[model samples]
Every structure is written in structure tokens, then in C-alpha cells.
Target: MRVSSIYVDGYRRLTSQKINFEDGTTILAGANNSGKTSLIDLLRVVLGGDGNLRAEDLSASARFDWLMSLVDAAIEGEDCFRALLEDENVFEKVPSVVVRIEVGYDPDTDDIRQFADYLMDLDSEKSSFYFEFRFSSKRDGMIAAFSGLYSDIRKAVDDCNWRSANDAEPGSSVFLVLQAKVDAALVNCSKPEVFFSDESYSNVLPMSTDKSFKRLFNFRAVKASRALDDTSDDKSGELNQRLIAVAKEDKNWEGVISKLPSRVVEAIHDLDIRKLTTDETLRSLNTVIESISSTNGAKQNDLFLDFHVTEDHAVQMIARAMQTRYLGAGVPLSEASQGLGYSNLIFLHLEAESFIRSAAQEENRYLVNLVVLEEPESHMHPQMQSAFIKHLLSRVNEIGCLQAAVTTHSSEIVRLSGIEQLRVLKSEEAGCRIVDLRKFHTEEIADKPAETQRLFSFLYAINFSDLLFADRVIMYEGDTERMYFQALIKAHEELAGLRAQYISYIHVGGAYAHIYKPLVVDTLRLKTVIITDLDYEKESNLSSFEKLKPLLSTNATLNEFFQDGKKNSPPSVADLSSAISADTGVALVPDTELAAVAFQMQPEGYARTLEEAILATLLDAPVWTSLTKKKWKTFRNESGLKFSIPREPESPTITQIVASTSNQKTDFMYSLILNSNLVEAVPPYILSALRWLDS
Candidate 1:
């Protein structure tokens, strides 16, 4: 049996959230304060033998609602308050934090006895059951106590109001006083209870105890704020502790090391310390006790203090002495000498091994094992993180019943893991939402199977997980644009603030930008700006000096952006240019206010590509003369440069010059960035795009 899903309500920020788990591992990823830690805490509290729920565990809204319910009952008559306290139905309506675990099992192959008590379905087709951990009131007398407190609060509030109405100063705020009292009362009255139910939660069977639940599920968590250090005084010998536990369970050490417990006692006895000092000390203590008894006129047997070591004490002493060491260079290095990163990694491995061994033990093995690794990338670098996740998965697969849920903020781990196992926790005003990326793709892009596969393949090849954690994204054309844009952002003061934000710059080019539309706009819902080229081609019959009609563009992304509901025909360049001038060239993605597209525009006469646009913007600048002589001389002289034609035309136009030197765009961009003030030469179209992104 495995836990397939978890439904949480009124727990911290998770007002009502459902998270589905994968068979092997379910990776929970999100920004800080998005409830990843809260979900992990919920799982641990429910399954880790500590079901204690404090007042702060409940959501702010839930707490206020529960408090108001009590106030409303008090405002009514005594009978209403009694009904709210004594009536089962009325009391059950009070708000409480609940977490429901849905377990899935195969009746034909798996042992149903593990969860037989929780089975609520009668049909054979159903293979799942629901078990809930609810934090609520579990005893009587809560009503009378609450009533007296409420009455005192009302009297205090009335006195304060009268004092304020007169000349005297008012006391503390009424709401604050009431809230503190409510929180205190709740902490004293509430407890966590376990229940069995069906799918709809309409039928519930409350378990008298959590013994069955504890026996069925084994949970372990590796928290992020671990007390890990390379110091001898470090109290958190987590790795060493797990090592000892696993070693005690190994049969190979039964007769050899396991006998040390008895040997410890024998070794202490051979020391003869009891005869040397302990006997004398006990005789002195007995004399004092007898003297005190005689003086009090009470007959009592003689008493004395003695010291002896038991097997349990010996075992504890051995455990405390154990330490982990790193072996290399013909010498053993203590954990204090090793890096914390490697130490943390070893700690995680030992934890996984301990969980696996515990489940595989023959004496009283648990039916299912679940491990929660919170921020496993805490101290490791990127490459180590990637390797750790891969190896962690291999270890998980060693046992079929083992399942792991990892919460991380590392893109490297996310990049290495399968998308099907990833769950993104997104926070909203109301609560949090867990988005299954694979399910989203299967549902949203169901019709484009080939495109979907291609998109994902390209994304993985380029580490697309970076975009998953970005607050905003900039998808531009080739490396030349990427380099130039980076330089521009750093050089321009207006756009320099982008350095402080989490912005992912993706080099998707124009041909593939349309493929990532659904993902960036629909799935991730990032604030994205796609900067592409307006690849304009010359007509066949146009004269050398005549204006080239901007009738068509070769860019697939640009074409799609300006499709305007047309099937095969694209908008003419004139219309596109007009839209650009009117600031309507880009369109916001439907239902998302953050996504838009920005492409090249004709700053002077019909600039085709980014190169043409840059040259056009720099045509009238003061640096034009030096730039032309230094960079454009090859095209102007037509002597040694390669082109479509063997002999390049002399005195080439700006368009012809750009076409001839297209292969050297990167070098040209770098030259301009190094030699000239390129920020002033930035095209108006790009400036507009950058301004929109900044906003």
C-alpha cells in the first residue's frame, strides 16, 4: 500500500489543497513561503507518532472563524451555548485543521491487513481508503470555561468603552485581549484524532487509537535547519546515530560487536573500583542513615547508595562514543576534517538506508515507508546536487514499498528529476495550489503530441528548470542577442534593476519561440517577453534604390504573433509598423496579464533583422563614421569577405552589408559593445520592450 494523495484543509497557508504523489518520488518545489514546509510538517505530525497541533498550526482565517463562532453562540441565549457545547452535530461544525491521506493498494498482490481497519468501500472496483488526522476538541467542560471567559471579556470591554466615553484613558484593545485568550484556550482544549472514511468523507469511523496507523506507515524527515557542522562538539550526530541503528540490526555483528554490551559490564567489574572506593563510600552513607534513624526514634533498615552499569547503559555509552570518519590518503579523517557538503550527503544516504532496513526487518516491519527530504540541496553545489538526486532515486527503487517526497528550491535537482514527479506549490491570495506539470501538459497540449515532445526535449537539453523558478523570463533569439542584451541591461541604468530580480534569459530563437508559448504563458504563468526578429525578404522586381515592400516575414514566431485570426496570410509590414508605432505590436496572452511578444521594427526605412535594426539606429549617430570604417570596411570594400556571390557589390547598402556579414554577428556585436556607446544605439523597439518588462 502507498499514499497516493494528500488533502489538507485549514492548516497554515494550505486552506484547501490536494497534492498527488508519484509511485517513487514526488518533488515539491516552489518559492519561499509557498507552504512547502507547511505540507511537510503536516505529513510529519500526522504520521511520525507526534500528532500534537498547537494554536499557531491553524490558519489565521480558520482561527478567527472559530473564535467568531464561539462569540456568536455566547451572544445568543444560554440554551444556544449549551447546544454548541453538548450537541454533537453543533460541536462538530467548529473549524479544525484536517489532513486526509488517500492510500492505494492492489488487493490481489498486497496485504490488505495493513489497512483493513481503514477500508470503507464495499465495491471491489475501489482500491483506495481515506484516513484523516483532525485537530479538534476531544473533552467536555470546554463550554463552561469558554462562557466564563467570554463574560469577563464583555465586562472588560464595557468598562473600557465607558472610560473612553468619559475623560479617563481606555485600556488595551478588546480584539487583542480576546485573541490572546482564545489562542490560550484553544491550545489547552484541542488534540489530534485519527479517523477512517470513504471518498466523499460523508461516512467516518473514528479510531479509538492510532496503533494501527502507526504500524502501517513509517515516516522520517530530514529537515533543512539541521545542526550539522564539522566540529567534535556538534550534538547532532545524525549520521552516526543512524549508523548505530543499522549496525545493531545486522546479523553479521550479532556475536561480534553486539556482545560488547555484556563485555562492557564485565570490563567495569574487572576494574575493582567498587572495592577500592564505592564500598567505603556506602559504609559511610549507612552510618549516617543509622544515626539519623536513631535520633528520630524510628526503627528502619540500613540504606546506602551504590553504582553499577547495566547492559542498557553500556549500549548508550557505546552509541555516544561512535563517530563517522572519512577514509583516504592512507589515514582516517574525522567528520570535523571533512567538508560539510560531503557530511550532509553522507547523512542523507544513511537516513535512506536506515529507513529501508527498518522496513525490511523481519521482527515487526512496517508495511509502508515514506521519507521527506526538505531542501536536500542545502549545502551541496549544483553538480553534487544533480548527482545526489539521481543516486537518491536509485536507492528508492531498491525497495518497492519505499516512497520519498523531496522539497527543494534547487533548479539542478528539478532539471534532473522527471516532470511527472514534480509538484509546484503556487501561493495565491486565498491559499496554495499544487500544479502537476505533467498533468497540465497532458491536458493543455493534448492535441500536439509531437510538439509537446519536442518542446520538452529542447527544454531538458537546455536546463529549462531555470525558467520554472524565475519570477520573469526573457526569451530571445541566438547567442548574439543574448550577449548584447546582457551587456545592455548592465550598461543602462533604467534596466539595471533587473539584476536584483530572478529573471531567466532563454535563447529559444524565433523558430522555436512559438513552441514554448503554452508552457511559459499557460503552465508556468510567468511574466514573459519574447524578443524576436522581423525577418523581411526583398521582392523579386524591386529596384536597387526603390523602397523594398515589407509584405512578408520569414520568422514563424513573428508571423504567428501577427496572425490576427488569418489562416495562411500574415499581416503586411505596414500594418505591423503602424501597430508598433501605436504601441500595440505586442499582445498580452489571454487570461495572463504578464506575457507579451516584441520583435524588430523599422527605425529608419525597412530594417529586416536585428543587425539591420542596429545599423539603422546608428546611421546618424556621432560614432557612425568610426564604426563604418572599423567594422563595415569589409562590406564597403568588397575585397576579401565571403558572400553568396563571388564578387560583392561595391558601396553596398546597409541591408546588403548586414546580409554579407550575417555569419559574423557575434563578433560585430562584441566589437560594438567594446568600442562604442551601444546603449545610445539601442533601437526604439528594444527600449520599448525593456520598459514594458521593467514595468
Candidate 2:
């Protein structure tokens, strides 16, 4: 789930404003003094936030005063919404600030409809939605004067079907039968994640490790900053060492190392391959912690990787590493840089991913359902910041985490992201005016590579692209898997929704499956359906598949591919060609059967053969151009590069067929034209592959 929209009313600098959220990563943008902070506050409060400020309280009017100071003076002098209160003097000028946020979920996987169904049942099926919000004052002074203001609005939304399509309420229903028109506009905003404001967020829990959860084996990072900041009085480094020492808690490194699948781990990946080069990486972290704890009073300066370890020299480094501006070149712990590193979006991704993964392993993944990041772009290079945002959005599926809303000042960041996910904030005549970027402009920017590729092709490619098919995308690693998936779907219509017709199945090549998988999972911010096999066609290829089998599936083993086939399980291209009577461009090894051939040449051959086979099977050319290289080359230059041509007009004997287009220079027509007999004989797997590619 992702925040689709946010609406603010009667709270901060101005009046009522509603902002829609984007589906993927979003960048919140506004100039300074544009009520950016108030927008943040409104989001925090309305989305199940605990704050001391209440709208009805006279003493709580100071926040409004701040708003007035930023806005007009007449509004501050009058009390329109707060006429009966002590701060009523400024109330007339202060318009009511109501914040509304819309949330979106994967349509295929959304449970909001279920929640809506449950709510509809509660209302005697009269309505699919209801209103519910708590408006208690955060502070005692504000609480004392706070009337039943919260209940009033709840009652209004409950009874009032008066919501315009534009005016979405917090408690909008989902039941189709009751106010279905209005219900369609009402978004499915449910539980979202909350995060600290900054490293200095005293508003909630400090990210410090708690002893209560120690038994859960919290995967604590031994950070360099902690070491740099560790003094005699402050011992985060010592704490980390205690946490990581392995031997201190009636345990030792020896035992821990012994328990690990060291040989297997080494076989899987080299330490050098995974080594952290930058101070920002997690690999160099443990070393920093060790260095910090070893010293009597190592300051932030002593902990920075630049000061201690170089790329070539960091071989001795260990643990989580993050660089802070305060810990830059040299600085003591007490006055050390605190916010610079943790304030970054990169840090958020690392920690949040870590937390989510750990929780998933423990089957408590719901803890990561909501993630709140405040000002993730703080001090980051714009590219790095955008990269961090992309990573975060993509992680939505890896951990099953729900919502992520980040604040940003860079329009470049916003422009780089999808419009569906953005909520632009601005201070208007009222408080903060929120604009759902997806709705704001007919013309919008698509910064993503895939979208850019699509747009480029649309503008210049002379053809439409696959992205035009759906609102969502499902990625595939290669043509074979793509084919298999499509074939399965075609074979069984129940799974047709998983087909490449609507879903974009990118075949980034087999070698890239591992890299492509995470990249797809991360960038799309959605969970992936990885179904691959070590089921190679030949025995020799088994070793090649084994090289990547570890990355393919956790359960993959040597015997896993054995289908107990008494004979050849997967046929080769030659066999497939015979089966379907389809000449799949390339010739297969002599005796290989259909499935093997399909697996090897299915993806490319299908397209190469299918298009030519269907278009026309033969191309006519003069004998001089056809046989002589010099004449043919000249003719090729004059005749345009359109090599796509027809095959033979009719089935010919081998001698006749081979006589034509047998030479390399003359094979264009042969390459273009596919043999129908071959196509007719192509195996089902290869056929499926062809259909998927063409589709």
C-alpha cells in the first residue's frame, strides 16, 4: 500500500488542503515558508499521530499564531472557527485546516476491499464506509479547552453523503451498494508506518536498542559513528562490542564461526566481492566500532573511514558503516556530527531494509508494514537521494512493507518520480494546499528508465510499446521463463492475468536473473513471482545451471530437475522443429528433441520465424545481385535496409530450397522467411514461447 492523497484542514498555517499521493516513490516539494512543516505535522497527526496541539484549544492557538505570522494579519486578528475560545482573536483569520490523505494498494492483492466489506456489514449493509478519527489535544492545556470537536466531524462524515468527488473524507466507505459513486473516490487509507523525525526525534522512541527485545537477537549494527561518538560516559561502541563480541555473553567468536556455514558461505560469495568501500557501506561498520571501543575516547573524527581505512586498506574493516558530516575529518563524540548520516535517505533504506528483513525472518514482518521517513534528502547528493528513493519504493515487496512517504525539497526529485505517487504541498490563502501531482497536470515527467524508454519509443520508435498495456508491471528474467509462464497461463486461463500480454516481461538475459530480480523487486516497489529452474536441457549444461542454482531457488538440488523421464524429457530444437514443422531460424543439434530446442532457440527463433512466416515466405531478386557479392552489396545499399522478406512461395525439395539463399550474402530472404511445415511442427513449449514474445 502507498499513500494516494493527503488533505489538511483547520490545523496549521492556512485552511483546508488535500494532497493525493503517488503509487511508487514520491518526492514532496514546496518552497520554504510554504507550510512544508505544517504539512508534515498534519500528516503526522491525522495518520494516527499523537500530538499535543488541538484545533479547539485556546492555549493551543500559538501554532495558529505561527501560521498567521507566515500568512495574512487580518486572518490572525479574527476568529472564524474558534469564536468561543480564548485564542478566538486569531481564529477568524485562521481558516479550518483539514488534512485528507488517499492511500492505494495493489489491486490484485489489496485487502482494503475486505476491510470495506467488514465495515459495510457493520452498517447493516447500508453503507460500505463510515467515519472514524480521534481529535484529542496532545497537550494538557489544549486538552482542557478542547470540546467534542473530534466527534463532530466524525458525525458529519458518518451522516453526510455530501462529499463531492473532489472532497474525499477520512472515513469513506467501499461498499458498492451504498453511495457507490462517492465510495469510488474514497481511497483505501489504512494503517501506515511511522518513523522518527530525525536522529534527534524526541517526539517518539529513540532508535536505541532496548533490553526487552534482546532475546529476539536484534541484528544490531556496530556503527563507526557510535565509535567516534563513544566517550567514557557514552559507550555505544562498547555496547556494540558487547552486542557483537560473540564471546562475552557466555559465547565466543569461535563458537559462532563454528556454527556458521563458513565453507558454504565462502563458496557462495567472496568477502572481497562483498567488501564495503565507502564509509557509508555496512561492511566497514564493524571495524569502526572496534576502533572506537578500543580507544579511550575516540571521537567522531577517530571513527570516520576516511580517517582510518582506505578502499585498499579497509580489508580489516568490519560492521555497519555510515558517514556523518559532523564525523567528517575529525570531531569528538560530544560535539560529533549526529544528524548528517542518519538524516539521509540512504540510511533509511539500509536500516529499514535491515529491520524489515530481520522481522520477515522472525515472521513478524508486519512491524515493517509502515515506514515513515522525515526529510530523506537531507544533505544527500541529488542523484544519491533519488537513487535512495527508488530503492525504497522498490523494497515495498521484498518485505511486504506497506507505506512509505518521504519529504523532499527538490523538484528534480519530484520530476524524477512517478506523478501517481506525488503530493505537492504549497501554502495558499488557507493553510497548506496539497496537490496530488498525478491529477495536477496533463503533461508530467517520467524519470524512470523504463518509462523514459517507453516514451522515447512512442515518440520516435515507429511502434507502440508493452507498457501501454497495464497500470502495473510484472518482470521476468528471460525469454524461456517468459515463455513458460505465458504458456502455462495460456494452457490454464485461470493464470492468464499473469501473462505478458498485460504484464511487461522484460527478458534482461539469463545471466542477469539474480541482478535483475532485486533490481525489479526494488525499483517497482512490489513483490516478485520468481519461478525459475535448474532444469537444463543437457547434462553438460547442468553444471552451468548449478553455478547459479544457489541464487535460483533455496530448495534447488542436483536431482531436482530429474522429472523421472524414462526417455528424453525436454526435446531439442530439431525435435521441436519436426514436431511443429517450424524452422526456428537456427538449426539444432542433430538428434535433440523438441523441448530442448524450444528451450534453446524458442524465444528468438519464434519471433524470427513467426513474423517472416506469417508476412511472406519469399523475396524476389535479380540473379546478378543475388549471386555476386559486389553487385549484391551495391543493390543492398540502393534497396534500403528492409531485409524482412518472404520465404519460398511453396514447399520445395531440399535441393531446390538449399540452392536459394544458401550463401551468407543471399540468406536475408531465407532468414526472413520461415518454413510453415517447421512452424507447424514446433513443440508446444516453443510455440508458447513464440506466442509470448509476439504478444
Q: Go through the candidates in order and give each one's C-alpha lDDT.
A: 0.71, 0.36
Superposed by TM-score, candidate 2 places the C-alpha of residue 13 at a distance from the truth, in angstroms, of 2.5
Query: What is the total number of backbone clashes in candidate 1?
Result: 0
Residue 455, candidate 1: alpha-carbon lDDT? 70
Q: Least lDDT summed over 10 consecutive residues: which range in candidate 1? A: 621-630
Task: Quote each prediction's TM-score.
Answer: 0.83, 0.32
**Which residue pairs collide in model 1, if any?**
none
Query: Which segments of model 2 are wrong by more than 4 Å?
Result: 1-3, 46-49, 54-118, 121-131, 134-346, 358-368, 397-400, 441-695
Highest lDDT model number: 1
Cα misplacement distance, residue 522 of candidate 2 (Å) = 35
Scored by lDDT, model 2 comes in at 0.36
Error of 1 at 534 (Å): 1.1
